[model samples]
Target: MISYVKGPLVDIFEDTVIIEAGYIGLEIHVPLSVLDRLPGIGMETILYTYFQVREDGMCLYGFLNRQDLRMFKQLISVSGIGPKGALGVLSAMTPDDLRVAIISGDAKAISRAPGIGVKTAQRVILDLKDKIDMADVLPAQFAAAEGPEISAGGVAKEAIEALVALGYSQTEANRAVGKVEVSDDMTSEDVLKASLKHLAFL
Candidate 1:
């Protein structure tokens, strides 16, 4: 029932953290990525969490952001993956990278996780590919202007987001936007209108 835990961090272990809130120390399992970002021991900490109850025990899984938590829940929804397996997957790669892999159908990348195998990795992709969108696959890529959209500014970024909202894949959006000759004074609508013309060719 706990949505999140906010308090001073009591301890940091290999795969778990103890956050003391209201005099109770709650043990939370988290990905290795979370450990790298956590503050020093006893510092104030906040983690979005998922609580699981089994016949044997109860546990909490935590993430630094809602995206990771959302990815974790999506991972566990697959047939062969559980909370721990999902944690391992998130530990292997960021949620963004995982989304890219799923979009590209790269099961090999996912199989590198601690306990996941090729078959299970493929199953993960098969199950989650439709659940995720290509728009989330490479936000950093677009923001850094590393991809076809050479500018991360208002016009190009909004055109990409709008195209994705229109149900086109991100790859399609980027290719379309990049071909349009955007002027400095162009609004997002101007770029979007020009991008739509280019989208037909893509």
Candidate 2:
């Protein structure tokens, strides 16, 4: 299996990218989110990839990070969701936001995806709820130090909400908050401040 592709980005289409690796231009379908994050053409890039083979043909799906690739694999494992559907879901929500929606049983959020309906969203939640854990989805900094203090009182959640209210996207909010270190006594305001500081550097 081709685990990843690393080379100069030669082309960027609506939902695909072409990477020139070893003198070959490898075309890869990517989520809209990944497409948006790609560097300029001819710049070196790397994408973790999933190669799918079917009776009719072969396809390659790429993601900006392993978290996204892992989430895509899990999403496609559901009964009705295919590669296209999974990509649509990722395009609509970042992996961290999707994990939160699933854990919180927010079907409406999942249904916001282009091709997903409420029923499909609920199915995705029901099927993957137990499979996903916050620790697994969080960045290493958050996951490793997630003590009861940090996990309690919904400080992280509130911080993310505050960031969103400040005009940040849900994905951006979640990512920023995930990088913070919190204690039991810290209020949502404190977390938000820290997250905002992190966002400033980004």
Candidate 3:
């Protein structure tokens, strides 16, 4: 099993990244948060990873921190939760926030994740509520500002297309980008810049 990888970041899209290591580019599916933290092309990065094998193929999911990876692992253990479903949850909330929701039995917050319904949300809380250490995951600040830092550019559409190419559902891509502060001075590039950061909030 691939535990982790350290390499040069070769590409960044909405939900995946290409990291070059040992003369090969390993494509990893990631949540929006990791995408936001990604440096520009050629930057060095290291990721804690989880590998999923199936009848069709094997895929890799990665996280910026081990805590996030742990949460992803726990999420996949739930019945009816696949890698994509787990990713959906992680994409909507931080590991800490997720733990808080589960500990507090906040079904509404859990259900807010795309494709996750109230029943599944309740199940998630029921199954994992006792399994997690709340103190370990909750951030000190619960109401901090969300979204990515915006810049001046006109590449919002380009960034969205890039995200789509990386295999994110269009709805997910739109949601990630929509959180940014759009303005008349903001171009597509500006949108992309902001979107990258906003993606991290998930």
* Backbone atom clashes (below 3 Å) for every candidate: 0, 0, 14
User: What is the alpha-carbon lDDT of model 1 when measured against the actual structure?
Assistant: 0.82
> Which pairs of residues have clashing backbones in candidate 2?
none
Candidate 1, poorest ten consecutive residues by summed lDDT: 138-147
CA displacement after TM-score superposition, residue 14 of candidate 2 (Å): 0.3
TM-score of 3: 0.67
Q: What are the per-residue Cα lDDT tens digits for candidate 2 across 83-153?
A: 98999999898887787677656788899999899999999989997787555544444445434455534
Candidate No. with top lDDT: 2
Deviation of model 1 at 74, angstroms: 0.1
Which candidate should be chosen as best, given TM-score against the real structure? 2
- Which candidate, 1 or 2, would have the higher lDDT against the true structure? 2
Candidates in descending TM-score order? 2, 1, 3
Worst lDDT run of 10 residues, candidate 2, spans 139-148
Ranking by lDDT: 2, 1, 3
lDDT of 2 at 153: 49
User: How many angstroms is residue 43 displaced in model 1 relative to the true structure, after the best TM-score fit?
Assistant: 1.5
Model 3 scores a C-alpha lDDT of 0.75
